[model samples]
Target: MKKIIILTLSFLLICFLFMQFFRPKIVNSPASADFQAPPNVKAIMIRACYDCHSNATSLRWYDQIVPVYWQVAADIKHGRESLNFSDWQKMAPADQKSKLWEIVYQISAGAMPLGSYTEVHQNAKITRDELSTLKAYVNSMAAVALPDDTAKINAADRQYSQWRKEQFLIKQVPIAPNGVRYMPDYKNWQAISTSARFDNGTMRVIFGNNIAAAAVRTHHIQPWPDGTVFAKVAWDEVEDKDGNVKTGAFKQVEFMIKDKEKYAATEGWGYARFKTPKMIPYGKNALFTTECINCHRPQKNEDFVFTQPIKH
Candidate 1:
């Protein structure tokens, strides 16, 4: 019995020693450029997300062990792929704001910093105060875009004229990079929901097709029947001195067309976006849908949708 136990211990030690050689390296290369935010907000992000989301990763001693190290490496790889603070300035200004907005969204949905990570690194867990601060900062970005009442009216009028010109000039229905066609029929669909997103300064209306409407009426929209379609149209939110809000400049329109088999890769829904009044299609390539899917991932339980339809 004593001999057997000794042999087993020896074998286990050897296995452990061999595995150490295979541990993956976590490199902390100097950042090319970093995300620019208020010092407080940046400090919070560094404490909570830098471990995996940024190039400046720091692993605890236990985290460097074989299996744990493997997982940490993988998490860092995917986390950085999603958003790397080191590469922040490389993105366009609009893209930077969008990414920050997405970060706030993921955190709000409890889909960020990853539960698995926070379990081991308690300091990485965001506090309520930190979340509140982040929200305030993001919302403040919209205020930067706001102008005086006279400028607001001028901007709206300019947008309206451009919209008319686009309607007259565009002869062909544009198609998204993902092969989803521009769905003009959504204009005839029922408005199912409306939202005023002050964080992004956009007013949005969600429209549902006959199939989606029927599913909603019957309360069968948990997964929503295949063929159910939704269109989300957005415009710049214009506010007057009295603080009343209305849709101003045309921003974009997006569609979610459902087909379990056809759109199996994208959570059983095809996504398309037409931007500006000219209806320019979004995406440089089909891979652009990856960004869309990532953004909607937190709402997967809601069939990857953010809108809740009103009772008709």
Candidate 2:
């Protein structure tokens, strides 16, 4: 027993001593002068997000010690790489808007400030009110910028229409025997928003029943409540000589259902798409499902839907 005690202490001391060699280098850089916000919003951001996401990190005592320091350093590195609030003005307007959207979605999903970080800095945890303020700010900016951003995105997509059609149409998606049937009632579901994918030659209008619409409008709740279902109807785009654009041929209809246990394989959401008049099932094989999931991965925090609630 005596020998074991001494050995354990000696081993721990050696490990602690060795950890000193791996101390992460702390960097200090000036914050961007143009990154201005409302006083309250800025305060919330500084308190909740600046540590890992900005150059001006306020390192704590444990942040300077050993393994914890390594984790802190790595997180700082990754956060800065993903988004540096300190360098906000340096990014293009579209990029800035995009990052702000990410912030809103992440905070809403409780994925920011990181659980481990909030555990240590209780003040960093955002209250519902603070989240609302932040979201409001983002929405205000988005209201002015999203139309331009969407136009730009659609323009770029138009250049890739042929390629997109070829990619989606070539896949052999299967129709399950127990697949979702077309429900006439879904047409009366509350309209959520409309979007266009010029690159795919398609325009889409999304609808969700009361439960799902309420979840989207709330903006802070996540994993949308079970029983919520979203239907997105898509059609080809056609333009008249007068520059009026209208829905053309029917493309497909896609549905996303939220049922945690039922769709565990697809991250708590079940995806299905039916194409053309016959409504043949799509995503029958692994290739189809993999592609769908990959495309939605970026918006996983927002329940895997790319179409955000239309700001009024």
Q: What is the TM-score of each candidate against the true structure?
A: 0.76, 0.53
Best by lDDT: 1
Cα RMSD (angstroms) for every candidate in the order listed: 4.6, 10.2
Error of 1 at 163 (Å): 10
lDDT of 1 by residue, 1-312 (tens): 999999999999999989989966778889988878999999998999988878898889999888788999988987788789988889987778768887887787777778888898888899999999998998888655544487776778677666545452456989999899987678678999887775568888899999998998899988999999999989888777776677688989999999999999888999999998768999998888898898787577778877766436
After superposition, the stretches of candidate 1 with alpha carbons farther than 4 Å from their true spots are 1-17, 90-92, 144-173, 187-193, 197-200, 210-225, 297-312
| Native-to-model Cα distance after best TM-score fit, residue 210 in candidate 2, in Å | 21
Model 2 per-residue lDDT tens digits across residues 158-243? 53353234433433444533354444355678888886543334578898978887887786436688878888988766554555
Best by TM-score: 1
Backbone collision count in every prediction? 0, 3
Question: Model 2, 168: alpha-carbon shift in Å?
Answer: 14
- For candidate 1, what is the TM-score? 0.76
What shift in Å separates residue 98 of candidate 2 from its native position after superposition? 3.1
Q: In model 2, which residue pairs have backbone atoms overlapping below 3 Å?
A: 157-199, 173-284, 174-284
How well does candidate 1 score on lDDT at residue 23?
64
